[model samples]
Each structure stands twice: as C-alpha cells, then as structure tokens.
Target: MPLNLSQYLHLRSVPSFRTILAVSVLLRVGLILYSEWHDAHSVVKYTDIDYRVFSDAARFVLHPTEGNVAQGPLGKRLGLGDPYTRATYRYTPLLALLLTPNEWLHPSFGKYLFAACDILAGVLMHTLLTSAILPHADAHSASPARDTDKHYARPSTPPSASPAASPTRREQLAMLLAATHLLNPLVFTISTRGSSESVLALFVLLTLHAAVRARWAAAAALLGLATHWKIYPFVYGVACLGVIGGERGVAQGWRGLVGQLVNWRTVWFAVVSAGTFVLLGAGMYAIWGYPFLYESYLYHVHRLDHRHNFSPYFYAIYLAYPTHYVPSSEPSVWQRVLASPLASFGPQMALALGAGVLFGRRRRDLVFAWFVQTFVFVIFNKVCTSQYFLWYTLFLPLLIPQLSMTPRRALQLAGVWVGTQALWLSEAYKLEFLGQPVFFGLWVRGLIYLAGHAWVLAGIMESYEP
Candidate 1:
C-alpha cells in the first residue's frame, strides 16, 4: 500500500534538522560519559591506536624530546613515537599542529574536540545539501517560481490539505543528509575513538562546499590541505577541476582543457593548491629534516603492513603472495610486483576510470561528481580501514537526493551497505583480535564489501534521471 500524505509528512518531519542536532548532542554527551567512566564494555574500548598516535605526536610537538644529531638533523628523536613509544607515526606535520591544542587542554579534550568536528561536519552537510544540491533536484519537480524561492525562504511547512503545499522532495533530502550524519554509527565510532579522520572529513566537505559555490580558490586551498594530510585527497582535484570546467561550459575536447587552463579561477586554484603543498612540505622538512620527511611521507610508499586491514584488494594480495601474510616472511620483489593483488593497481585504475566517468558526464551537477570521485577514492584505496568510511559516508547522503530511487529502494540500498559492513566486521574482528583461521573469511568479506559498493555505484549510475 502506498503511504498517504499524512504518513509521508510524519516520516519527513522525523529527520528535521533540529531533531537531528538534538539527538546528535545527546549521543555525544553519552559518549563523553562513557569515556569518563572508562567503561570496558564501551564501544570505544576497541579504539584505534591512530588516536593515541595523534595525541603522542601532538605532545611531542608541544615538548620536543632531547637527543643527539646522530639520529637525524632534527636534534633528538628520529621520529614521533606511538602509544608503546615506538618510532612509527604516519601523519603529516599539520595534523600534529592541529591537535596540539587538545594536548594543552585536558586529556579528554581531544575526544570532545573530535566530537565537535563531527557536529561541524553535519552542519556543513546540511548547508551543502540544501543550498548547493537540493535546489537543483527540486527544480526538476516544482514550478520555477517555487524552485527559486526554496532557498531564499525557510523550509516550507508540511502540506496541510493542499497537495501543492506539501514538503518538496528537496527539503526531505536535506533533512536526510543531516540525519544520516548525526545518526551514522561510523561517525560515532570514529569520534569516540578520536580518529583524526574527523578533521580530514571536515576539510573534505568544506572543499566540496567551496567547489559548489564556485569559490575556486577556497576549494583548491582546502583540497591542498586535505591532500597534504592524506595523499588520497589528491584525487579530489579531478572533481574540482571537472566541476568548474563543466560549469564554465568548457567543451569536452582538448580545446576545453586549453580554455580551462587559462581561466582565472583555474589558474588561481592551481597556484594556491601547489603552493600550499610545497610550502607545507618545505616548512616541515626545515623543522625536522630527513627523518620527518621519511617517516611522514616516504613510509607510506613502502608500507606493507597487511595485518587485518579491510581493503577488498587485500584478499587477492594474500592469496597470490601468502608469504606476505607470514609475519616472519619477507616477500621477494617479484612477489610484490607480479603476485600482489588488486589494490596494487586499483587506485590508478579507479582514478582513470573515475576520470572517464566524470568527464563523460561533463554536464552533470558538480556535487554529484564530487561524491562519486571521493567514493571511488576510498573504495579503491590500498588501505581501507573502518575510519576510511568517513571519507565518503557523509557525502553519500547528500548525493542520494539526486538518485532516482524510491524511498523504499533507498532504504534497501542503505541496508545492503550496512549489512555488508556488519558481516565483514563480524569476520574481521575474529581475524584481527581473535586467534582464528579466518583468512578465507576475510576474502569472502572483501568480495562482499566490493560487491556492495559496486551495486551502490551501479544503482546511482542507472538511476541518473537527471
């Protein structure tokens, strides 16, 4: 049976922005209480060591450890240490600087700070959805007069009896985006665990927001900072460039590329983006020298820590080169090059394929392409961790409004995503924390995760009513 007008209105009203914020604040308070009590049963008990690493690095930044020049040119320590005091920190220097305030304040300040960032991200999601994405989605369904006024006026009240006065599809979607961020389990987990992905996620959304507004310099600068924090964000450049190019009505050929290259916004974007990366890199190198550069940047290039990572490509790497799975065994170069699995080439292939897709849809809305780009970025990454979902989950809800699926279909797709994650985590936890021969189970989980995303992507593509 079809939902009646009142029933649909009730569903729409449930995810109102005010309701989402209230629930979010309450959830954060609960997390804070749980954190204060140090409850073992709390979900944060299985917190990622990445949080501790951030705190330690920031602390080191606040107070440098004394050492000799023999370690490196940077005075005492060769690198920042982790929770166990191991010299293995793996983030850019800017992140440490960003978190230093948490160190200066109370020990628990960092968790609260991350929680605040998550809230900020939700706000940004609301703005992006309502101002940038939703208006266009509504334009297709409503009269031009209503569409133009949708943003200028406050959200229209739910329809009384008049069908024309009903809450537009756009308002419902904006609420959905906010609700998804506020209630997302992954956001809660990452915030409670002190994952720095919160900070990165904020920058990512801000960059998209800027891109949507055609504030090219702001978009580029934000993307640069985000890319500096994590190399994967470099792929975001494609979305920004593609969107701006399309907006300007740049043609789909080499002539368009040439024209866009000379555009003032394009030139400004390129300059600021490159300048940020170079200046930051130079400043960090000046402060810490070779060790800092190697530990922060080069380490990732050679990182082969294949222990319990959630990448779909890992299973192929494990099967083809089983010796890499052996803690004591070092795979030969041939094994790494020839026998290594999907992620070995996945990023490049995904980027290429994504570029093709985005460029082909050169006339599609920039926001849609941005979500697609970032989603592909995280999915095909060499190291897919639980926290990595934050890279795109916040953006996916914003894109959902544009997809031509019914509410039931949307719920079903979300179920596929969440169900796959639940199944994968069940097996992953067994292999990661428990001593179980769940190696094959990990493979199954990877296949399922990969398939789920593929299905979601296909649905989005197929449902492109625009």
Candidate 2:
C-alpha cells in the first residue's frame, strides 16, 4: 500500500534529522580542531574556574608523592578557610580520576584528550538513541535464507531466530530518543565543554539501555560504573530493583519475587558496585589518607548548605521584602528561613525516601523517575548552577518524545531550554541587557524561566499514571 509505504518513508524523512546528526558530529570535531589550533598558536591559559581546579588536581595526580600543594593539601585546599571556596568549591573524585590520565600528557594536550572523550561520548549518545528508534532492515532480503528456498519453505526456526538481525522495536524508540537529545542546546553546549557530564550522560544511557533490554547483570555493572562516576545513578538502581520485583511478583509468585531480589545476578551486581566504591574510596584514602577522603568526598556533600538562592525562589523573597532586602556576605535571611526545616538531615532523608516510594515501582517508567529525581534535586539543592542542567539533559530526550502535547507546546518547551542557555551564556560572556543585571540579579526573569521549566515538569508528572 502506498499509504503504508508513505508511513515507512516518513519515518526516515523527518526534516532536520540528518542536519541534526551532521551538525552535532561536525561541531564536536570543529571544537577539538579549534582547541588544538589555539593551543598550537600560544600557551594555553586556564581561564575558567573549573579549568583551574582541574589543572591543579591534574598536577596533584601526576606527583602525588611530591606532597607539593599547588593549591593546598586536600582538606585545606577546599574552602574551609576561604569564603569563595565555600560558595563555589565542590569536588567529585571521579573527575580527578578522569583528569589524572590527561595530566600525563601536556595539560593542553590533556584537554584535547578530554575533548576527544566528549566527542566519543556524543557519538555514543547518538548511536544509543539511533539504535532505539530506527526500524530494522528486512532480514530476508539481506540474508542467506533468501538464496536458500529450503530454509525458507518450512520456516526452519522461530521468528525470533535468524541469521540476520534487524533492529528491534526498542531500537527505533532509541533513535527518536537520540533525536531529541541531539536537538537539546544544553546537551550540545555541555558536550562541547571540557566537562565530565558527557561521559556521565553516556554511562546513564548505557545503564538504562541495559536495564530496558533485560540484561540484568550488565545493567547492574553499568549502573555501578555510573555510580562510581557520579553517584546519582544509584537512584536508578533502586528504581530498577523495584520494577524487577514488581514484574516478578506478577509473573511468578511471592517466592519468585523474593528469589529475584536475591538472585545471583543481583548479588553479583551489588558486589561489583560495592567493590568499585570501596576500591575507589581506598585509592582516595591512600592518596590523601582517610581525613582527606572524608573532607573531599563526604564533607563535600554539605557544600550545598551554603547556597542562598538562585532566581526561582529569590524573586519571590525579593518581592516580599523589596525595601528590607539586602544581599549579605553570609547566608541570606530568607535562605535561613526556608532552610531551617528542610535542611535538617532527617527531613532530607525523608524527602528522598518519599520520592523513592512514589516512583520506585516502574523501571521502564523513565519519565517519572527522571522528573522525580530532577525536581527533588533542583528544588532542594543549595546551589543551582547552570551546568547542573547537564544532570537531566540525557533523560530529557527520552522523556520529550513521550509528551502528548501539541507541537506548539513542544516548541514552547524548546524555547524554555533556549532561554535557559541564553541566560547562562549572557552571564558567561558578561553581556548586559541594556545595563540589566545578569541572571543572578534578574530575579524576575529567573522566576518566569523557572515557571516555564515547572510547567514542562508538571506535564511530565501528570503523565505518570502510577
């Protein structure tokens, strides 16, 4: 049927599909080439705040025994004595692991390596999504079975088995997922920079992909790797176990459910993940001793307590006290006011537990899990840096295509993403809007943008049906 043919053709004919793929690939290549060119032209300078920290960390990793403190020993190196450090400094040991190898090469060359990893990460993201969405090739036409009438005559095997394997239905879904991510400006910007987010995103994707494919052990191992890299992916593991347990209960029995939870595969995954954490922690301890590990990793968790407000809440508080409002060197009065109850340890744990109870049942419920995790993290976080957008960027693509909204709704959401980047980029470039203050100062603009983000998130939440 021509209509059927049209449907098939349209799948591949989507506008901007090829362009999106090409541009994403080309931009990454260009960035690397440009960075290399710039480095060759002059001595590379650490201009960005993260760059300085990374450079110093790289030096430490290179000569750990030297005991030479470029910044300071681990505990003192953190903002214990420095106010700016308290406000801005946060450390993830995984970042140091990534940077250490790059430090072996010249720092500039090492940047190139990091950039290359980002490019590879981008490509992997692209492939992962493509594998999700594209339709499978016609196996018969491409296989030896076509030439052998005997093999085809009686159907020698089940439909599931064949010499040629076409892409599965899930793979087509992945392709669409990839398309959304490719178009995401935040993903584009983050991938271009020398951040661990691209890799972090890749690992998340891999873990999810493995989980969805029912590769339980592989999923666990990927999740373990992801946890070692960032720590948030552990939440995904909780979601996965919930789903597996639920599915097993329905399909098998209570005994089966219990057995599935304590299955060899699950045990192996737990061991692998735990072993990884212990090994990494041990390595950190060896390098800087237990105190340094505690300060850098454990104490770093409390760093968020210092953040007063970004745009979202700041605007509301500002309007309430327009005359009395004065930004202080210490935490804002409003921050303390809102902080007292929520910032308490018991409440934070309860909040996390509540979110887990809410969305833990569906492993395949990507949208719910993403929304819950992102919302909780963003709303409660002490600091909401623009780069934090990277945390949810990978999940956004998969969630976006599932929305039932009109194209206009989609466009509006897209605009919000664009606006977010515009605000951040303006700050980054020190561009003033007719003497208007930056994002940190434009409290009203931040509130409006926050509302837009909330609207999209609400759509996601409403779509989740238990």
Candidate 3:
C-alpha cells in the first residue's frame, strides 16, 4: 500500500540534503539519457536553442579556420557592434574556451559538464548556508532561552512540549538552501539546456563563499571571473566593500568606512581583481582579437532585445519607441544618446544611486545586503531573460536563514513569483513556439512580471532594513 498524505508529508519534510541532491541527479540523468537516445550531438541540430548556440560557438573556438560555419541568421541579432563573422558567438571568449569539449568531442559532454557545474553550485551553496550564514543568523536570532537549551534540557526540565520535536534551525535551512537550488526547475532547465549559466552560477556562489570566509583576494578574483562571464556581477563590487567594511566594524560612520577602505587588504583586493580582468581580457584579445571584446562586452553595454523579452522597460520601449524597438548595428551618435534609457542606462543609474543611499544607511549585515543588491540588479535589468532569474535564486536561499518572514508571507511571496513566471512563460510559449499572435499579451505579461518582482524586492528591503 502507498503512504497516506500525512506520512508523505512527514517523509518529504525530512531535512536531508542528500535526498535533494539524489533527486537532482536523477533528473539530470533523465535529460542526458534522452539526449543520448536521440543521437543529438551537433549544436545547430540540437533541441535547446542556447545549447545549440553555445556548441556552435565552441566549434568555432576549436577550429577558428573553419570556413563553413553559419554567420548566424539575420533579424535575430540581440547585441550591438559591427556585424559579427560568427554572429551567434555573442558571449565572452572564456565561455567559448570552456565549451571547447563540446566541439572537439560530443555535445553530450557539454551537457554533462554543465550538469556538474549545477551540482557544484548547489554544494557551494550548501556549504555557505550551513557553515557560515545559517550559524550567523541563528546566533543573531537566538534568545537566551534558545541558547541555554542545551544546559537546561535535563530530566528535571519536565520534557517541555515533548522536546519541541522538529528539525533544528540549521538543519532546516541547510535542506531548504540545498533543495532550492538543486530542485529548482529553472536551474534544471538552464543546466540541461546546455547554457553556461551554470558555470556563472557556480563562480558566483564560490565568490560569496570566499568573501564570507574573509578571503578577500579569492573573492575578488572570483568576482573578476564572474564579471567576465556575465557583466552583471560588477554591481557586487559595492556589496564587496560593504562586506569587508562590516567585517572590520567600520560602520561607525562614513569617515571610518572611507578610512578602512584605504587599508592594505582592500588595496590587495583591488589589485588582484583588476589584475585578473586584465590578464583574462588580454588573453581573449590575443586569441579572438578586438571583435571578441566588441561582440561580447561592448555589444551588451548597449543591447536592447525587444523580441520575446519580459523586461517592463523593453515592453515600454516597444509600445512607445517602436522605431527603436529593434536595435541597430550602426546607430548614430544622436540615436545612441536618445536610446540610452531603453538600453538600460537609465535604470542602471537609478540602481547605482539607490545603492549609494542604502550603503549610507550603514547596513551591517553585508551578506544580506549584498543579496538584496544582487536581487535588485536582476529585476531592474533592461534585457531581463528567463535565465536571469537564476541570479537571485542562487542567493535568495542563502539569505533566507537571515530573513524574518513568517510562514504565511513566505508562501505568498513564493506563490506570486512562481505564478507570475508561469503566466509569462505561457504567453511566451504561445508567441515563440505555438505560432500565436501574443504582442498584446506580451505587454500584459511584462506588467505582471514587473509587478511580481517589484513586490518581491519591496518585501526583501522591508525584511533587511537597516
């Protein structure tokens, strides 16, 4: 006989990272088996678009002299710059170099590599949460009675409430953080879809781990690598300073903070971070030339992909600035200035200003503040994509142990986030795959996404208030 509902719930609620990781592995194995049975080894002929693109680009990296590779299709250009020789290769050279095994061997190898990175990210998240953040949060939230429980729990204690049987706070948080990343549908999609987002996610979690452990140079180096992989982690610079400063108890005032920043450790972090960027960038330039920088980094600096994107800013640009709906490769200087806001400059500026104000408030919990910072960075981006959600998903679980949200509020937030994503993706599927006209519905979906994410950010700020 099958387990009843209560039994099922009891078993499911067990705080076991091993169980979560096992389920994650099973899901990944299914995806890999499916690919193998289909013999889908080539990039272009594969099912997942991003994976296909990554494989194709990796092929170019493996054999730069190959003359037969397609120069990407027209009208599908998302980033700016000169017409790319290999138009589909829009990511950093490091990513191409990383994906070379897919080109040299089989695409299945690439899928497995990404799966490994996905699992590695979960491991790093578990370590960060269980070893560091959870303990710190527990200490902060623990009361005298809670801390004294060990000493007071004798037979004379009268067995208060049957020992309050439940998983300890640390165990619950460890399972939650591990399972959130490992079992997240979005994480599975990106990993099996063959996107390098998993690699980026791994580096991000590692960077945070290093930072929390007071290994500033390691954190800075990892941050540099992450920034090269995806430009968004540049925002983490502010949060890094905050973390280091908070560690040194420099929150007395701005003057003390400024004085602390001039210390040797901060200088070392800066030197190491800049040195990493310079070395990696010089290597890429030598391998792929200026076009690598242009296509990969500069292109994204002014990118505006209105097609099938869910950014509210891009949606407004589509409806209001139809001429600027699709980006131009050779936009004039005047056009560039006029399109800055739609290109995400305006919102980025607003985010920078907001970060300044928040920092001024001297929020001492640097890790939690950094989580909020990264969350806002993703939500306010102009070119928000489906995979972009992974940015916060990686950090949110780490931050959860620190948050004070009630069970009801947490449920509401989770419901709103998942519901909005489902609704938006439903419309997106109709437009991209089902051959339906969803232009108007796209606007509605964008609004819903914006509102949902905005609500989440508001709640985070409220919970993490200084």
Backbone clash numbers for all candidates listed: 1, 14, 0
Can you write out model 3's per-residue Cα lDDT over 280-338, one digit (the tens) per residue?
A: 87766655566767887888776656666877676555544436545545665655554
For model 2, residues 48-132, the per-residue Cα lDDT tens digits are: 3465566566555445332332233443443222112222334544465466655566554444544455545545555644544
Give per-residue lDDT, candidate 1, residue 248. Answer: 59
Error of 2 at 328 (Å): 16
Cα lDDT of model 1 by residue, 163-269, tens digit = 32334644565676687787888787778767777888888888877877777788788888887877777776765655555565656677776565456765667
Q: On lDDT, who's better, 2 or 3?
A: 3
Q: What ranges in model 2 sit over 4 Å off?
A: 1-25, 36-47, 64-66, 69-94, 101-106, 109-185, 250-272, 304-353, 416-448, 463-466
Top-TM-score candidate index: 1
Each prediction's Cα lDDT score?
A: 0.65, 0.51, 0.65
Q: Can you tell me which runs of candidate 1 are displaced by over 4 Å?
A: 1-7, 15-19, 39-47, 68-86, 143-173, 253-265, 319-334, 338-343, 346-353, 356-364
In model 3, which range of ten residues has the least summed lDDT? Answer: 1-10
Error of 1 at 418 (Å): 3.2
lDDT of 3 at 110: 77
Order by lDDT, highest first: 3, 1, 2
Better-scoring candidate (TM-score), 1 or 2: 1
Global CA lDDT computed for model 3: 0.65
RMSD in order of candidates: 6.0, 9.7, 7.7
